[model samples]
Target: MSDKKALNFTNWDTTFDNGTSEDGSRNCVYMSESLDYKWVATSCVEKINFL
Candidate 1:
């Protein structure tokens, strides 16, 4: 639920660093479940139970 910078969903930014997302899907910022809760970029279309 952490974003690279302070951003609100109403005006969320879709920009990412040079190599931010592994799958090249930088739609939303979410915490990784299998990576010890590290922040990662994922597609906003995906349904995640956790926030």
Candidate 2:
């Protein structure tokens, strides 16, 4: 019989907030332990503007 390793899974809690501004500027925030929160924000904005 062949031996193999099972994949491991992680449980994470996340928080998101709408960063809408009064001037009609749209923004978003995401928080997770697996990644840098700031990076997520920057990446999201970049994607939105790119579209």
Candidate of highest lDDT: 1
Full-model lDDT for every candidate: 0.57, 0.40
Per-residue C-alpha lDDT of model 2 across residues 1-51, encoded as one tens digit per residue: 246667664433334333444444444434444554233332334334321
lDDT of 1 at 32: 59
State model 1's lDDT: 0.57
Per-residue lDDT value at 7 in model 1: 55
Which regions of candidate 1 deviate over 4 angstroms? Answer: 1-25
Each candidate structure's TM-score, on Cα atoms with residue i matched to residue i, is 0.43, 0.20
Output the lDDT of residue 48, model 2: 42
> Total clashes, candidate 1?
0
lDDT of 1 by residue, 1-51 (tens): 355686544422334352445566666767655656556666676678873
